[model samples]
Target chain A: MSSSTTPALPMHEVRAEATWLQRNKMIVTPLLFLLPGMLFFAVYVIFPIFQSFGISLYRWDGLGEATYIGLANYEELLTDRNFEISLVNNLKWLVLYLLAIPLGLFIALFLNQTVMGIRLYKSLFFFPFVLSQVVVGLVFSWFYLPREGLLNTIITGLGFDSLNILGDPTLATYGIIAAGLWPQTAYCMILYLTGLNAVDPEQVEAGRLDGAKGWKMLWYVILPQLKPATFIAFVVTIIGALRSFDLISVMTNGGPFGSTRVLSFYMFERALSEFGFRMGYGSAIAVVLFLIMLVFIGYFLWQMWRDEREARRG
Target chain B: MFPTPIEKRSRAAQITYQSLLPLALILWLLPLIAVMVFSIRPFSDFTQGNYWGVPSSFELFTNYGMVFFESDMPRYLLNSVFITVPTVIGAVALSCMTGFALGIYRFRGNLLIFFMFIAGNFVPFQILMVPVRDLTVDMGLYDTKLGLILFHVAFQTGFCTLFMRNFIRALPYELIEAARVEGVAEWRIFWFVVLPLMRPAIAALSVLIFTFIWNDYFWAIVLTQGPDAQPVTAGITSFNSQFVAQYHLMSAGSIVAAIPPVAIFFLMQRHFIAGLTLGAVK
Candidate 1:
């Protein structure tokens, strides 16, 4: 995504000013520009990453003196049933959360036309993505409210029954995820819709000429072109799954006996909430989550690096 | 274009598409629509088992007024504004310079620094929770709006820098080159030549950050507590616990909390989408 094709600072211009400032321009200038953002980024982002890992190796409450407890936090995480549950729930989230991509693509394909009021439809469809997940969680909570909730009302009206979805340990995570997928699918749809708009018309026509249409055309001709959108969708979906904090916090509070707890919420419960301020344990969970995220981040950066290099070569 | 235009299809197909469009949209937005309608109805309706009926009387003004006056919603909303507006300005301001530095220059660590910002933007917030909270407490920033604002600005710079550097990179380098040739100071070149051309990027980022910061709920919980400095997102969660079964008031409060971002999305839809779908289309 590097922007400039033509680099500035042509050779002749470098010698125009013999002053010390101009002589040292390249080194001094960029640093001067970068200082403020780097200062903040280092203190809040970079430094804390290492510090979090350091804290993970200690046995300390948030209050007092720290004691080194090497690997205890991580070792405990191995046997902790709640940690196991949260880890398993996270895996479930990653798998079920992937449904957003195809669901979004289906909606994108459904709505990717020049019909009347299509723009309104597009914006409305994407409206949920704009609202806070807190609101989404609340709305769904109300929608799933035991007997009088919409889900139960409809079920009871049909001579059936409904369960307290948010209160059921087995069903809770899936219930929260259903609420989550509503906005996530909308997000993915918008990405694919944009990708679809930019697909090559000539290639589509060429595919038609070769007797390609429908699923054949989409698979062979169009899906390849939508690779960028798919990659972004995958990246966001996976990250969103990992960062599944706000929804769980709002909907269940890792409730129904902590069945819905992802690493994020569980870490918060251990470190910050009323459970106890076990900073070491919280940071240990965080470090594990960070390692998981690093794998994805490293992959994404490598892909971008290769592409940037390939761009110059091509 | 991929599936072939539905316009050229049969009349029945066109009618089906048109009808299904709204139906699908309504079905998709059912939970939200239910909440929106519930927000304006009187509390009597919820108590009387009128969950999905037309309101006996519209309490739009009453509900919203209560949210503003009878509750801490106003304070929470104000806290959101105080925290969000400054973070947007600070982050965008800093990123403009960082983006300029990394985007235009071919320094020793240009790609390294750029990659750092890109990678840092994706780190889990929980990873920063313990140490960041400790840092804020050490600075006397715990449970304060300024603390939240500073933290948000710093954290957001990673993303804003990514947005801005790419934005600046797309601008013509010739403009900067010409300014340099005229013996203009480097900072002057950035301010006069580059900054004016970056208005669209600034607009895109300003709106994008506005929505991102406004909709942030996790940090609001991790950093601040109570109505004193808690933003509306976290405040609403507190409201949920206090006002159990009071769905009308909760619904009203939710709408109030959601208004700013929704309004921004409508007003600056173009820039918001442009910023969000930056690389999606290739």
Candidate 2:
């Protein structure tokens, strides 16, 4: 109002001179800004989800006439041995992958000191998380190679039998999960390291004065401060566990009797691999994964919403 | 501080802690160290069954040279650059607008839209795979780098928006309000006032998104094929098949494939960690 040139102009003329867009710039501007992003997101991310649900109801190859299957793909999943293995493997991934959080907290506690060269050590220990999962998988596969591998060399040197980890069905999933855990532990470590940086000195001093130390101090004082980090670590770890396709694709290719196949890898195989493009079946598998993810997604969103509310109230 | 600083400990304990740091680091990075050692060794050592021994010959240059000069590794790397750069720019650009709108405004459905981006980001990629592939093919974009970039930009927008909006929100709102009171256009405020302050966030998101798009393997395979358009992550598979059982060359190829993002992380460590640990503390 102060910037208006004709401060003495009639109020009716001033109001008439303002265009609709000018009058509603607050609403118009945000809507205009949101347009392109919303369009792309809806087209590529949001709509695809509902489309997958719809696609799961019909049998359609990539280049063929569609046949409405109406949950038949899901019916097959009920009896499909591969699907069973994939689901169970997914569960194993969810459970085992979570070990990264506590393990990460441990490493963070160890590295939280103010030693010289600690920065380099911290980055080096966090190195694995920066490398691509594909590279990690390749490195581990070579490490686990049967005859000339380093792992076997060490085992034999220690007078223990050399084990072909990826070649055995029972061990393959665990082997791949171990590989997955390397980067994941590094990721969680970084989160906790950041969390530990912000821990209040006064609280630590108080805890010390109260005779808290080691595990007791950590459980009572440090862990509470690390809750935000733990929450994020949990979210990322669970998502990483479900999104276990790249490592499996690179290392095992769902091999060793398909024991390492998770829902993600199985969905890809069903949808596009040479085994036959069963798009509907793949869609069905994807829907199941999405539903599982939705549970966690809902929880994360609810937490964020609660935080947002608290921020508003405070 | 929680672990008790080494300075406060006894001298022997201090020495032990310092010595144990390196030992623990070596153990933590053993697998990667093994690969680095593998990459530098000559093929003669592998043939002589001298694996894990001191390299009979250091062939670092020779092996990486073959990857660059004699294979499709160069093409794949270039493709990776093309794919990653555009996706980073596109996602960051779009999210900046979305984040600005969501951050600055008090419009209806703002939180709803914000939650949508968050939820979409957390959905498994497989749920979006088939339809996105179909949509790409429908637009005659499959088997093209553009197809991959378009989809990556869209999907990553979810996460980017989440990061960006939160970053924008943390900025002082008074600047925007002051700009508005001064009769500055909304778009001008976004461009001048908000965007200037968003440099650190932009830098962080760019580095984070660069690593993500560069390391993307599943989409590379799903969207493109062969050396023509496939990024290094997908092309590494073929690179491996071409040099099967040639451990030295394969290791070199893998190292080459992994270098760019690792390099970026080291170069921009501050921003990278800031982007990653955005909400971990606060």
- The candidates score, on chain A by TM-score, as follows 0.94, 0.95
Number of the top lDDT candidate = 2
> What does the lDDT read for residue B110 in candidate 1?
86
Candidate 1's docking class is: medium
Per-model TM-score on C-alpha atoms: 0.96, 0.97
- Residue range A176-225, candidate 1, lDDT tens digits: 99999998999999999999999999999999999999999999999999
lDDT of 2 at B111: 92
Model 2: residues with Cα > 4 Å off, grouped in runs: A1-17
Candidate 2 CA-lDDT value: 0.92
Q: List the residue pairs that clash in candidate 1.
A: none
Model 1 quality (TM-score): 0.96
lDDT measured at residue B184 in model 2 versus the true structure, 0 to 100? 77
How high is the CA lDDT of each candidate model?
0.90, 0.92
